[model samples]
Target: MERPTRAWVLHPDIRGDDRRRAPEPALEEATALAAALPGLAILGSEVVRLPRPHPGLLFGTGKIEELGAVFAAEEVELVLIDGPVTPVQQRNLEREWKLKILDRTGLILEIFSDRARTREGVLQVEMAALSYQRTRLVRAWTHLERQRGGLGFVGGPGETQIEADRRAIDEQLVRLRRQLAKVEKTRALHRAARAKVPFPIVALVGYTNAGKSTLFNRLTGAEVMAKDMLFATLDPTMRRVDLPTSDEVILSDTVGFVSDLPTELVAAFRATLEEVTAADLILHVRDVSHPETEGQAAEVRTILASLGVGPETPQIEVWNKIDRLDAEARAIWQARAARAEPHVAMLSAVSGDGLDAFLTQLSQALRGPESDETIHLAYPEGRALAWLHNEGVVRAERTGETGWDVDVRWTARQKARFDAL
Candidate 1:
């Protein structure tokens, strides 16, 4: 087997910045990110203090020399900076340290490139990566001085290698955009078909490694890729689930949210996240066992709001991973969740505990006003009858000489679908 690449993670702690996160937790999260990428062995990690960023080298001369010696001693193959690194700074750092360097955006792009599975996902990542690379062409291509030969009659001077490379990237981006548009249209059609169904969509959204996929698998019985890693499940997955109230719902597992998520990723995944926006209900899953649970929750909420999820949208807070907590903490959280009924649910998705309560709350939140209605359908309308039965909306039925009388207890959407049929 090929050995893993030796890597070191460094989280820059900007001094006197009140808004800056705690250095320890930030460093821990960065380390987690590094571990998520396959074939990377974390040699070590640290929080590099920076009172102010240097224009050329980001770190002071003394610190540069110190880290260089450490890198040499450790035989590090790559260095991952946990924050933004300008092109010039990245070039200088690599030159001084004699190792490949990846900034926060570049690292995320790499992870996304590795994780994306669907055609749309692959296209989006490629487009985003190209867009990011376009900004660093100067440092990326060493053959910028090369120029193409041209005929004197047609052109005096041909384009340089850098210009040609940028043009090629831009052209590829355009093609990718066109292809993405086609895929999006296909997805829209699929969504439209799903919209015609009576089932309401419930989306699971949370921070990375918060067990959204675990809960999804527990509820839907689908083997989606769920792991204890950041961005483990990048492509969205959806399945139909039967609730306690006998109401069927479409549950969607979405990409996790993170603190300071790269802007390019946000824009690139907009189509995938539209599932959340179109959902009839949103389940904001939280890993309550994490030390930075509140901070992560805040970040998820901020991203949701940025996506235009208004206060009017129904949402349920799912406090997941309670199995990881101690008895005392679990009891306290359970009590709190009980008091916050209909809005919060404390559950361990892996252990299948408290899931019934969550389903009950989900049923309550999704169910609209109960409407009892009787309808007469001819013998030829078996499709509608089967739909009502499949949706678990039929309460009673009576057969007559000419037709069948069906009584259904359903929500307004179900009633409307029946009416349409």
Candidate 2:
């Protein structure tokens, strides 16, 4: 097998920026991002402090030369910058260092390029990639281990970079959008069909590698990609989870959120998150053991709000990955979680701890108004009676002269569906 391309990562911590994140944690996350790509080996990473970005080279001349010398001495072939790099900066940095350089947006696009599987996913990724390259078409993007020309950053052998001309890129975008529209229409139909079902949708969303997929797999017994890798699962996967309360919900494991997600990819992937908007409840999972967990959770909330999720959708905080925490930290989190009660549940998805309470809380949160009613149904309405029994809501029943008197306790949603029937 071909050796993984050696790479170095840098997170520029600009001074006097009120919104600046903790640089070390940011560098750690950026390193993880670099590690997520299959063909990249993160040799080292650093937080590069800067007074301000230079117009052409991003970093000052002295710093640029210093970094170039460092990369050369370490045999680094690629320098992955953790923040935005202007087209000119990318070009200049590459020219000076004699190494390929990828900004955060380009790196993410490459990861998505590697992970996207479904036809819709592939098309959306292609369109987003084209839009990204449209701005910097003069330079050849460093394709990875494939040894192909052009934007082969993540594709396999025989895959070639495409569409150099502005008109050509626009035409490709139009084609991809058209194909995606068909896929989306089919998805809408499937969603409409799912809506006819009485189950509630509970979407699992959190920062990438926050154990969303692990929790999902534990709850639903389906193996989704639960590796300790960023963006482990790109497409959303759903499974019917039968809660201990005897209630069932369609649990959706969506693409994970991340700090500073690229704008192009966010727009491309927005439609995939429609399941979230239509959900009855959102499970905001978190990696409680991580040092930057609070900031990560805040970022997830910000993204959710930006996606137009409002107060109408109820959300529960799932503090996951307690197995990775020390005893003292775990005790503190447990107590903190107790005070938050149903709204927050601290658990370890891998160890199956605290999941039961979390599920019970989930059932309560999703429970609509309960109605107690005695309904009269004729013998011909046996199917409706069976449905009530199947739902485990039947309390008592008595045969009458022409039909049956049924005592059932169910939620408002269940009542409505039965009424429609």
**Candidate 1: tens digits of C-alpha lDDT, residues 296-405:** 99999999999999988899999999999999999888889889877999989999988897888889889767888898989999899999898888999999998789
What TM-score would each prediction reach against the true structure? 0.87, 0.91
Winner by lDDT: 1
lDDT of 2 by residue, 298-364 (tens): 9999999988999889899999989899999998998998898778988889999887888888999
Task: Report the Cα lDDT for residue 159, model 2.
Answer: 18
After superposition, the stretches of candidate 2 with alpha carbons farther than 4 Å from their true spots are 137-164, 395-399
Clashing pairs in model 1, backbone N/Cα/C closer than 3 A: none
Error of 1 at 338 (Å): 3.4
> Where does the lowest 10-residue lDDT sum fall in candidate 1?
147-156
TM-score of 1: 0.87
- Number of the top TM-score candidate: 2
Clashes of 2: 0
lDDT value, residue 111 of candidate 1: 84
